[model samples]
Target: MSRPPTVWLTRASMLLVLLAIMLVSGPARAHEFRPALLRLTELADASGQGGGRFDLRLVAPALSTAGAIGEGDLTPIVPAHCELGQLRLDCGSQGLIGELGVAGLDRHPVDVIVELRFVDGTQVTAVLGPDQPTMTLDGTSDGTSGGADNDGVFADYVALGIEHILLGPDHLLFVFGLVLLVRAAGRNTRTLLWTVTAFTLAHSITLAAATLELVHVPGPPVEAGIALSILLLARELACGQTDETARDSPLLSVNESTKVSASGREALARAENSWSWRYPWVVAFGFGLLHGFGFAGALSEVGLPQGQIPLALLGFNVGVELGQLGVVALLLVLLAGGRALAGAVGLSEKTARLATRAPIWAMGGLAFAWTLDRVLGFWG
Candidate 1:
């Protein structure tokens, strides 16, 4: 078979392997909430003295009566604050809330024991719940604790940005394509660095503009365009041609008089492949902007706190960058190891070329499948 034909077949086989791997791995799920938030409020008397009315806000999810209560019983185990025993609990219409008498006002920090028992025989004790911002004794609304002053909107936007990118399937596929294309071209490190930087800059620009209401693009068209971009890229890889002309060019030139040795020809072919190292980066930059807008849309849904927007946005962006780095690192390890193994196996230059090219086709095919699914989702 001709070189291009062989490359196409190899890619098809690899696509099947990737699809199988994804199927067997199963869907990913998030972990449960461990420590709930605990809010401590100081009460004041009419004379401006500290009244011993300690309001404890215990944050726990509401459960149905049919569901298990704390460790099958209503009592929770107390470790330090209370003697080594279980405390009586109250189930309210909203959730369980327990108030303890505050006797000491001189203490800078007070320790309290909080526990929960589930009907399934699960018990949990915590010295403190998740930290919440401090509130003042005065009835006047303070800047802490989900007040109007909170920068919730910005924070939600950033968190949404991170979550959307991490969980997004199409974004993952595009990143994979970037990695595969970089590996195929033999310009791994330089291409990866620049590609990531370019994508970050491009998306951040659009994210800021769109979030601030400085720029607007129709949602449906953007989504459809994003899917189309993926399909075009996949086709480019599958075709194994730089352009339409290259694709249409004859697959091979026959010459009986001067038959190049397989080893020499393979070396030349490998060198030639390096020319396309930047191609994947170009594709990634284009699609990444669209993905960022998708992130913005999800953030809009969650709604951010105006007061805590900075902190929330920081946390969310950190999560996204961490996830993207993780994916890229895994791809690098897998592809790099595979390349080393092929070299170590002492496969002839010709065979190695054919083997490595197989991964590109596989990557492209997967991209195609993903593009089709995404396009259908957009239309439907």
Candidate 2:
């Protein structure tokens, strides 16, 4: 018996969904190579009148379940200068107090642990808890002393921003989605360049505004929104309707054909067709705004120096852009090389065309899986 058109479509959709799911969730691979390093710097009161004794404690687990941080833990990994409170006395005009250093510790979501104790035995910890009040270390005895210095503070902010984007899975996933979109769309070199540029411009605006306190959007909502963006992209891919140009590309047609066996010839055709120069840039610009806010949240956690907010914001944005560019570069190289090889081998263009569907389906599935996970996480 012949299947109904609707049934066939449903089956096809389901298959596509499954493929996307597998692509994303196939491996429980570690998203980041290394955890963010937690650095604690302490300055003690130089008056020498206050007690030198203070408490040092860590609220979060310092190691993963794999026991990778075994033996040499927070205490040992911490730099020697700050370990014994030497750096505390070295903060120039700022009265040096007791310093405790913790390093090489790993945690998810957030890193960095700090605790302060007074001679009277009163202690403060950086753990986010009701009992432990959050304290802003403003480089002053009164907690509001230092006017934000532009130099050191901005440098730190920029470094942190770069590190956060590099290690952030959500950000990476968003970037990966963009790359897939570009690939599927068969964007030309000019288009790819412009798209990346647009994304950079868009995100940089939000990141700066948000970081500078000019705009304040809550973290949770922004994160949830980011996950939603991923879902939207996945939906687009699964629906198999992006732009008309992307869907009807001749290169894609050749790549999709199962009859193509020559990898070299296939590669060459892909190179020739990969040059659509406008649509992808527009898409990137739109999505880049969402990503920038995401980056802002991470940078804000460390607290930027008011005076150097611009520098820090700029640096952080630069880092994120670099990471995005790196991903795009890799994708271009892989696709270009693959197409070249296929073309040389005289692969059947039809077979090559058919091959493009696998990656699309796989990415869509993964996006769907991530979306589901995020939704459940939010509600559940």
Candidate 3:
């Protein structure tokens, strides 16, 4: 069935606007995997004295398969036991490796997440990234106390949380989608403001809950959901036409032989304006809950400081919002500059109207493709 001309033009406009965003974001890097993870678990020693032997597992993939994250090779760390076909390098009963690095130890060191799980059900997770490639597990700490500074625990998690959101482009892209949903377009600052707030509040709720173990959702499922959320917003963009109510709204108007008459156009204008005001908040809050779980999932993979769970959780949420706000500010600046440049060029009103919507279309396309791939990846 042919879409109404209004719908088609609207989608076309959105696609062009987001085309730049997709290009800048590099469409090839959707849900890119993080550096290698080196997890160390301590089994319970007999007599309950603690200090059990550690088991280490490193999972890295060089390539992704459909929805699954591909692992990188570990031959550099242990050429004797590591094989090209192996997805995981296990230390077996040998305990923690004396030294660990990625394929190119000298040239390119990567992060190894060391998770020291104790018999007492506590965990101490620390990253051994390029700056700190090798780690020595001091079994003496008993895995129950603060290995890092107690007062700085919150600060550390906040930094990690910020790093996670910024580095996790998928989450940031979702925020980008939210901005498009209620950005400064046509002076929708109020709608954008409330919508962004709602997103913050909602995600904070879930991030706190999930991180605290008040609720639990697995990594893959949460990831799939985040992708779907973006997909839904994209579909919304495709179906939504420009706000004819706004004089400068890039969406086509009724007089241009749209699918509607003048009256219908007015009706659409009101609906669209209202939709912009309302939909972003509703969508942000709803999808934000899922996104929070997604945050917890990422934090889990990297591991959290057991002694400072509350601080870590809170810090991570704050970090994510800071990253989100930073991106939003950048987007607003770019948007203003783009508008200025567009006006300076004296682009036709028609061109400007449609041009603004291009980004929405691009965002939708990326989200849809990601949703499809991630959903299919559950089989892995």
TM-score of each: 0.52, 0.59, 0.68
Residue-level lDDT of model 1, residues 1-380, one tens digit each, is 46765466456667676875466223211111112223333334476543433344443322212322233222222112222112222322212222222222112122222322333233222232113212212122332122323244334334444545655655666666666555544464777867765666566656656765678876655555655565565554444432111111112112335445555455445434543443656656767687667555544432333335455456556556666777888877776676567557655444454554455555555555545554565666
List runs of model 3 lying over 4 Å from the truth: 1-53, 59-110, 117-125, 135-147, 184-194, 212-224, 238-264, 267-276, 378-380
Give me the displacement of residue 12 in model 1, in angstroms.
Answer: 8.7
Quote the lDDT for 215 in model 1: 81
Candidate 3 lDDT at 164 equals 63
For model 2, residues 1-380, the per-residue Cα lDDT tens digits are 99755455446766876855665453322132232232333324466444332233333333343444444454323222223343232333332332233443332233443334343333332322112223334434322222223453444445544555666656666666666666556656666666777878998888888876788887555665676676666555434432221243223333244333345444434533432222556666777787777767655544543334566567656766677677778877777777777677664544444444455555555655655665555565
Please, what are the lDDT tens digits per residue for candidate 3 over residues 262-342?
653665555466654357688789888988777666555555666667776677677767767778888877877877887
TM-score of model 1 vs. true structure: 0.52
Return the top candidate by TM-score: 3
Of the two candidates 1 and 3, the one with more favorable TM-score, higher being better, is 3
RMSD of each: 12.7, 10.3, 7.2
